[model samples]
Target: MNLFELNQAYRELEERDDLDLETLKDTLDAIEGAREVKLDSLASWIEKNKMQIDWVTEKVKDLQAKKASLTNLNKSLQGYMTQSLDDAGIKELQTKNHILKPRNYKASVVVDSLDDLPEEFKQTKTEVTADKKELYKVLKDGQEVPGVHLKPNRGTVIK
Candidate 1:
């Protein structure tokens, strides 16, 4: 039976007290068996999907490495072309589909030493966070903490 049917049967069996003990036990066993099968099927899917995820992750890493290599090559070729154009004193070159020219960009700020930077040019950031481990210890010892409370963690493991 499907999950819904199995659950319905379990609920119905739970609410009934008229059946003989043997029949009740058998019915509950049947429901439990169905649920077990469903769990097994679900776990199997999880295992298969996990394998696929690992494979895709590896593929993505490989592709990323290739892309990085290509990007570096592109940068190297562009740098070489730009340097060659500069050596030749070529201000601009026009092709059928494109025009290549050097243009000036705004100067970028480079920080040599943060400590030596002027105070007015520097900014400070502060962060505050709760100490969860310490809080857990206190809460677990039956002490109350403001703004937060302990919660029971429910989790499942499959093998």
Candidate 2:
């Protein structure tokens, strides 16, 4: 209600000579008590909502950090795996098994035996054929066959 309406209502109540003073005081007290109850209820509602808001906020932050860590871990693993494939000569295995004869060898040995390999078998190419006549000749001449050189994990250097 507008201020004028409220003022009029108060004036009317005050001018009511029929109502006893005790009854008027009791009614005013009841209105004040109701206002207090409403305020208290509103405070409780805010408190409850705050608990949920705090919990959700914490969970969101934790998830964000975990996501970042997972992403970094994935990238690190990808890089490590690529290095492993390169070191292990995975490409040579695939090409040799699919297109070349079964001369079981590692990448380093295959690279060193480049002279013995046929033009096609030196690496992997479309026009490649392996003629191991030279490789066998060298071995037959008592020269050690060129193979993958594997040293002990920890040992004296042997040149």
Off by over 4 Å in 2: 1-33, 92-159
Best candidate according to lDDT: 1
Clashes of each: 0, 1
Which residue pairs come into collision in candidate 2? 120-128
Best by TM-score: 1
| Per-residue lDDT of candidate 1, residues 40-135 (tens digit) | 654665576789899999999999999999999998998898888899999999989989996667988999999999999999999999999999
Q: Give the range of the ten consecutive residues with the poorest summed lDDT in model 2.
A: 96-105
lDDT of 2 by residue, 1-159 (tens): 454654454455545667787986664454323454534433554465678799999999999999999999998986676666677766533453453222334655335666776786555548676456876666667677657232336733222
lDDT, each prediction: 0.79, 0.59
Error of 2 at 89 (Å): 2.5
Please give each candidate's TM-score: 0.64, 0.34
lDDT of 2: 0.59
